[model samples]
Target: MTHDPRTALLSAALDAAARGWHVFPLRPGTKRPALHGADRCRTTGDCAGGHLKWQERATVDPHRITLCWQTSPANIGLATGPSGLVVVDLDVPKNQDNSNSSADTPDGATTFKALCERTGHPVPTTHRVRTASGGHHLYFTAPAGIRLGNTAGTLAPLVDTRAWGGYVVAAGSLTPGGSYETVHDTAPAPLPGWLLELLQPAPARPVVPLRLPAVNGSRAALAALEAECAVVAAAPEKQGNITLNRCTFKVGRFVAWGDLPRHVAENAFQAAGEARGLTAAECRSTIRSALDSSLRKVRPRETA
Candidate 1:
């Protein structure tokens, strides 16, 4: 039986809607939205697949999906965020938008490869769509109260997330390059704990300076840093997060002594804490509390 591509896409659209994903219409045979003539693409970024009012227009209504497909077998796009999806879009930039330049950009697959190596955490198993550009759209359920964004190159250079301001071309959408096909049809998986933390912005970590050590001691400033950080990293997995927090408070005492610059200590300790299983939130809270409470209001001492 020769499968009708348009009919197949329509069926897929209904399936997605039934699963609670808000759906929108993409231009036929394209990954772009089926909107034009002053009612067109006003939003940018990952919204390259949709429009300014894409969210408002997205629907789970069967009547709307049928009407859209009847007009034209428009490619389907799934609106992210509101329905709790955040797609990890892996892009392979083949050419500049304005020019026919075939300059090579870091493709999504390669970036994802690098990320696995750096973080020592593998990408989670999840519902996946293969893009026409040979990229991937790994869908994950968003955590409550956390607003993720379309970030590129920070977590992994070639990776872009389709979140609050973006939409992903649905599995059945046809692009000029090819169709967005499902690699995995199962339920979308929860975002990994580490990844969820990585996606959010780093919180403010301020350190207050206090009086310097009078003798400064036989202990080199860096030696103290090295020792305190070792203690944090060596914390046992059982109650490890608590141990790291207390060690951080001790390190904050060093910051107060001006032996360690706030940024340097925070970065070292954070990297260590993550390696030891502290969530980003846990690490930040500990560091901030330590910085706040560890330093005393004593007067400065004379330098030797």
Candidate 2:
């Protein structure tokens, strides 16, 4: 016997809950949620609450899934940060055609691929979901110890990350834009360490001085720089190369602000990459590419 499409969807939601994913109901044919009064929801550190919006109360309970879907056929939306998973959301590029098809060769995918290639980072071959607009959702287990935030263009233009304070429509959801479908059979892979480092905000660190100053004891600060050097020096093959570049670029900004002595900072950056096993030539080339611009172009820190 053919199962009702709505029933199949409800069953799918239950299956997701079984995988320890919290889910909420979305409108039948759109990413817009089906929760009532969701717009009026608010939360605070001391207290949190929402209006009728179901997202304020998404659940993983099988019973809750049944109650939600049975009440009305709804799309499935996975809350990202709350679920400890992050999704790389490659959105379909805009089109004047308005052909009404979800599938298309949008700029987001191309940009993402180029970024991966440039970073020497491998695109994940793990669990993926195909979005209606020909975009894709690459899912990964959030790395421990870093709070990743949702961002657009943090990685590349048209590419977005859904982490804390964000959500992604699940694979089984149907939207007027299109239906989400699983593209890969495997479970999500742990997010790559190099990528995690890139996603995380850089720690606030003062630049190393030309010589130890008698001004004050900041031995701890110097040690932190040493640790950063270690990470670059030991970065995994090509994958870590981009991270090293990014690290150097951040340091260059400090140099631009006069927070770090340029000569001292450069020597430290070179040492870090070399320590991470990079050849002197490789380190020199990357350091130049990454730091030259910021030094030439960045403005000094602004006064309050």
Candidate 3:
């Protein structure tokens, strides 16, 4: 007995919907969304009031899933945000790349494994999918009230993540390469604490206003410089030098525009970084380097 392709696709959508994942339709045999874009919206149905993107419109209702897949042999698209999933996509190098050393190039799986070993973490076992390109997707449940955005090469080279603004071509989808199949039939594990630490944004630090004596510059420039110095002074522990560099670099644009003098900016940053525990030498070196780079990159004031 042979299974009808349409029926198989419908079953795939329903299965994902059953697991509480919000499901959308991918174009037949591809990972692209089948939904219309905002620009193409006709102000009808779901978009009567405003356009709903694929993530906003993804559904977990079994009735909607059945009705959708019955019309076409569409692939299943799992919206990671709505489903509370954070999927790590481990991908192989593209087949079209003709580099002679391609065979030795580390793929996402290899890099991710090395990262795990270095961090003293075992490769997390979770609900996994083998994608058409022979890559893998490891699904983890996102922590409540935390929304993570998609990342490319942030965790490790070749490793990408799909979260709030992303989706994954789920198991049972097909492409020219092959079919995506469930390699591990299990519930998704909660995202690891260590990984969560890496993904979470740094906590915002409170900046106590800097009271600098009168300086030679526009009032706007003086205020901006003071605020930036306060940010450096309030940087979290062990982050003082990095914060000093960033803040000084921002003020450098004003220097380039002649809104502030370089000496004044440098002097203020030096004082702020020293107050925040950075060595005088470290503060001077970082401030000089940051300003140099910022000045070099800044466009002419008129164009800017």
Which candidate has the highest lDDT of all?
Answer: 3
What tens-digit string does per-residue lDDT give for candidate 1 at 1-304?
8867668888989989999999988888876777553455565654566555667778899988887776677899888977698888888776545377645545777767655655667767899899987889899999878888766543544577888878988888877778888999889898887778766655433323222323433366557666766776676534445566566666666677777677776776776666665666556655654555566532343542
Clashing pairs in 3: none
Measured by TM-score, how close is model 3 to the native structure?
Answer: 0.67
Ranking by TM-score: 3, 2, 1
Error of 1 at 223 (Å): 26
Q: Evaluate candidate 1 by giving its C-alpha RMSD to the native, one decimal.
A: 12.7
Q: Estimate each model's TM-score.
A: 0.60, 0.61, 0.67
Q: How good is model 2 by TM-score?
A: 0.61
Give the per-residue lDDT digits (tens) of candidate 3, residues 167-280. Answer: 999888889989999999899999998777656654543445566767778888898898999898888775675688778888899999998889989888988877776655
Order of candidate numbers by lDDT, starting with the best? 3, 1, 2
Cα lDDT tens digits, model 2, 1-304, are 8767689789878877777677998888888777656354464421254243344467788887897798787899888876778889887667725678546433777767766766677676778889988889998889887678877655654778888878898888877767889988577888877566556654433433323222222454345445556667666644445666777766676666655566665677776765555555545656765677568756656741
Task: Show where candidate 1 strays beyond 4 Å.
Answer: 1-4, 36-52, 96-106, 205-304
Alpha-carbon RMSD, each predicted model: 12.7, 11.3, 10.7
